[model samples]
Structures are given as C-alpha cells and as structure tokens.
Target: MKWESDPEDFSPSATIVPFDPPLPLLRAPMKAGLGDRPSAGSFVLAFKDAASWRSAFRATESKILEQCELAELAGFSLARQ
Candidate 1:
C-alpha cells in the first residue's frame, strides 16, 4: 500500500477522547526482506503501558467501524496475539 507523507491524510476524523496516560501515536518505519513485494508495508503502534495499549486498541476498533460505515473500508477482523 502507498504510504502518504501528508499529515492530513492520516488525521483522525473524530475528536479523540482524552484518556489517562495519553496514548501517543507511534509510526514505525516500514521495511521488507528480499523477495518481498514492494507494495507490502506495515507500521506499528507502540504503547509504553497497558493503559495506553487498551486506549489505542479501543480507538482503533471504533475507527474501523466508522470507516466501514463511510465506505472507506469493506470490512475488518481482529486477531489478537
């Protein structure tokens, strides 16, 4: 997938509710091994504590639903490790 450098493209549409220990958004650099498709890329969100982790997870879940409703996404499934 193409990654946009424009901050506006990644901005959340809804106002994020403030939570304790405020979850800071982390964007990891994308990398690939030999033979990997150039279009394949991924980013990770790292949390410093459980509170931040849970807060981000819930926000992500809610965002996915909102995107689907807006036709920006077809569907999504959660896979917890």
Candidate 2:
C-alpha cells in the first residue's frame, strides 16, 4: 500500500477528467498472504469505460460495506454503556 513513483509531471492528460482509456492493472495479493494481518483497505479507483469500471467497483464495495455497518452500529451503541 505504498508504491509512490508516478509524478514526473504526471500527465494522465493533465488530471484524468474526460480521458477515457489507460487503467488496467488489477493486482490481487493481500488476502492474508503477504504479511498476514492486512486483510483489506488497500486502494485505487480509476475509470472511464467497461461499464464505468464495473459501476466503480460496485460503488466501492458498497461504500466499504456501508462504512463497516456504520462502525458496527456505533460500537454497539457505545457498548451499551
């Protein structure tokens, strides 16, 4: 989750807006297989076609499962405290 190198005047046609085409490298390797504890939260979302990039990756996995179910129902209503 930390690969930087993409600036050099980074011209994706000066900031992507209507630039349709050039984003296809979906790597999938973090399922408890690279350092074992990081299960998710890695990121990247670029789109223009393929059905709006699969509906923007299912609306970003349904908004990260609706914000982890509203932060586990606000931490179970503050642990019923």
TM-score of each: 0.33, 0.27
Query: Considering only N, C-alpha and C atoms within 3 Å, which residue pairs clash in candidate 2?
Result: none
The residue-by-residue lDDT of candidate 1 on 1-81, one tens digit each, is 468566676667544556689544544344555566656654333455788668778989999988778663333322321
Residue 37 CA displacement from its true place in model 2, Å: 41
lDDT of 2 by residue, 5-68 (tens): 5675467776667847976554333324454445454532434457766877898999999999
Q: CA lDDT of each candidate?
A: 0.61, 0.66
After superposing candidate 1, which stretches have Cα over 4 Å from the reference? 1-45, 72-81
Candidate 1: TM-score? Answer: 0.33
